[model samples]
Target: MHATTAIVTGKPGKARPRGGMTKKRPVDWLLLALVVVGAVLVIAPFYLVLVNSFKSPVDYATSGPLALPETLDFGGIIKFWERVNFPEKVWNSILIAGVVSVLAVVISMLNAFAIGIGRIRGRSWIVLLFLMANLLPQEALLYPLYFMFKSVGLYDNVWAVIIVFTVIQAAFGTYLLSSVYGTFPKEILEAASLDGASRWQILWRVVFPISRPTLSVLLIFFFIWTWNEFLIPLTFLASNANQTVPVAISVLQGDRLMDVTTTSASALLGIIPTLIFFLIFQRTLTRGITAGAVK
Candidate 1:
């Protein structure tokens, strides 16, 4: 039986002497083509914007959308910066977004930690209330919030915007952090308790170390959301100096119309910080999602 099997296998090998080279399968080529097509579709718009940013206004309007620019021009960017008070706007945006992100994360972490790990009664009801708050539209609360802020003399202040953003962001952040904390092993927490560690120590030493990925993900998301927020800022911030980046960009549109080049430049500028942030925290974001999924 062994001899017969060997003879059958030998015949096929002898029939194809050069079988060492594995031929490209049809599916492999098809998948490669699909990937190439998808990449082109995703990249084309950015390429158009970048090329057009360097073109003259006439060229930008008349030239084919996909065409490369003949020469680079900084006129659009220069005009945008001068007209928009770009430096001051950037400073305001950074301060607002940075404070909001930090406050949101800190507040969410405390709320989630208390509800998840502390022996607190009515946790479920509290969590449910937060979830319900998220279900309500921001517009629905705007009138009440406006009156409250006005009464408190916070209407046009940065604090008003910060408080609103923090409150809005905390609900979702707490929900996500709570879900993540729930997946943590009770045994580990119990072990810490058995070791006579204080609650604060256990939280700082063990819980935080393990939850870094999730925290990083939440921080990035909150920063992006707060930085790009428009409606709340527009409604609450009455002064030009206090306007965030999104609000500033909206105000770029004049009575007649906006300058296409300047608008495009400002739009591009608005995305730069977010793009930089994503590049820095992309790995943490991936890890956070994967950790959550595994848990």
Candidate 2:
């Protein structure tokens, strides 16, 4: 008789014959296939962008987007770079995104502290109002903002875009941070109070340190969102010198007839800095997300 060995199933008195093979579940395969498909969908665009960026116009025309380039061509990239005055546009984007990220996070923290920790009357309603404000379409506010900024002589300036995004971003940040802060441990707050720590001291020294991970997540998000903003920046930053990367690209695309390769080069250039920024902060993002998930 063939000997049957037992396999422990991590339960008391629960064992299966080692000789028995576990049947592969159709559902597991299906889920894996779905994940692979999702990954492909997400990666395909970046692949296309990278591939075409190195192709010359002639090569692109001869061989479609999917085909490998005949040679590494820098001409298209160089042309796009010089045509748009790319460094200035990049600087504009970095400045706007960086400033907005910091300001928005600070504003959100203060707002969340009031609504969440303070437990003020009608705090729920206030949070709901902020959420409603976030839902308000930017299109509806465009003309009023335009008029206001123009009157204040802030139109066609990077600061105009910065200030606009700071408020807009802060609305969502406040809503999110409030929810996070609402669940903060009362014991900790009480202990801090007992220690004679002022509200200001508790906020800066205690709450801020504990919430740093979430704040870092918010900061990265705000920067990326502000970087990618197109409509408001295009409208407010009318001058070429003041335009962000997205605005510069749109302007170039609209004003000139760009071949596939050059257009791809422009897109690649536009996204590279943002990609680098994300890479640098990717560890922080991962740690923050993991930390936030734990209690």
Candidate 3:
């Protein structure tokens, strides 16, 4: 019997055992090559900055931008970091982005929750208003805010920038959260209501906790947006002390110094937080950013 079984198992025409694994489809290497090429193109600028940031200024100017540095250089990095007071600039950006993120999330959550739950008489109209408001370009809104902030003596203050960005993000945030909440199982919310949970309690305890991933994505987006906000901060904040990293870097690179290597180092430093945020919370971002981005 054992010999017969072995002969059957080894038969040339017999189907092979899967060993508990699903059969994989043949890989499309052409598609893979295209994707790899696209990824390289997207990452190329940052890669160039990283490599060239280490080259000496003279070497950088003399050599091809794409070539690897012949000798490592730290002097430019140190000088730029100190001259720009990079740490202070970083701190300023963090403070602005942090505050903006929190405020935007809170405002967005409340507005979305109200709109999503349909507790209002004109819910659709309210949502439409928000969507319309969001559609207005920043440039269209900028001058009015510039005038308002200037009138209130908040024009040069970081708070001015913070307020503008928070409000802008809040509109989008509301749209995002409302879409998510609209899909909630009605029975669960009904059950919570039957259990004597107040609307506020339901929102804070049940909905908020459940939507942490979404909120996290919003926060990350807000941080990145405000962190790299250049034109607003540049126009509003004229002083070196008030400038965020992007504005600071731009000002330092004006035609006077013309120091390419140090400017690259500064830019690299400015973007470190953005990179770190992406690396750490990439999975979380995927869940919310995509949904929010689409509509």
Candidate 4:
């Protein structure tokens, strides 16, 4: 009363513009429509596989892939599982892919450390060599690798696949990681050096830890690549006991007459494990890729 106070009658709230709600630009709506269309296109094949996989052969033939299953059929799945010795194939794939991923990443990191951080002489030439290795098709080396493995009594062994893929994958990884490590922040290295960190200590505790996200992406890629490798694994892992999942799928079709439903069921089984793996590591892959975009 003494200071001429002003009374506020209405509740405080955000003021709307003179017009009603803002209208979205036409470009925005177009982009949204395009995204929806792209998503549908990408998802359609998986939808067909899933629907057909659960249908009986007769149901699949009658209604086609676009139609929903008349009844859920475990028959196709069970038949493929038993005939292919699916468990053994899965175990073999896991063993090979796991080993290759670790070995390839480690080998790549060491090579990258030397080339990028150590500043080895002729580093450009070395990188170029690795790049060339990637350009060479797998088919080109198949015969040589086949003979080499066969001569050493490692043929038909999971180790053969593991060893060959480790080298192949590491070549590309080294080419990639060298470029990444080359751009390492000098300030961080200087700080670590001032802290009395030896090169080995820095590699393990400082550099490796900082580079973990990129390495995780590489590890995931290596695992998936090795798991899906068909020709090399098919040739190297001859026995049913040693064959990987992809080899098993091919072998299944070659061994018997598979109806469309059975084939779809096998394809579905083959994809589920890899899809689960990708989903689990998806966040890590995204983070790794985006990490470089920011500071």
lDDT at 20, model 2: 88
TM-scores of all predicted structures? 0.85, 0.93, 0.86, 0.89
TM-score of 2: 0.93
Give lDDT: candidate 2, residue 201: 97
Best candidate (score: lDDT): 2
C-alpha lDDT of all candidate models, in order: 0.81, 0.93, 0.84, 0.89
Q: For model 1, how does the per-residue alpha-carbon lDDT over 1-295 read when each residue is reduced to its tens digit? A: 5566568786423333275766779998999999999999998767766766666777677775567766777777787777778788888777888888889888888888888877369878888888997899889989999999999999999999889889988998888787667667889999999999888988988998888778878888898888888888899998888887788788885624565666667777777877887898899899988986776
* Candidate closest to the true structure, highest TM-score: 2
As for lDDT, the candidate ahead, 2 or 3, is 2
Comparing 2 and 3 by TM-score, which wins? 2
Q: Give the per-residue lDDT of model 4 (tens digit) for 155-206.
A: 9888999999999999999999999989998888889999999988879988
Can you write out model 2's per-residue Cα lDDT over 202-294, one digit (the tens) per residue? 999999999999999999999999999999999998888999999988888876577778888889999999999999999999989999999
Q: How far off is residue 197 in model 4, in Å?
A: 2.3
Return the clash pairs for model 3, or none: none
**lDDT (C-alpha) at residue 175 in model 4:** 97
TM-score of candidate 1 relative to the true fold: 0.85
Please provide, for model 3 over 66-94, each residue's C-alpha lDDT reduced to its tens digit, 9 standing for 90 to 100: 88999999766887888879888888898
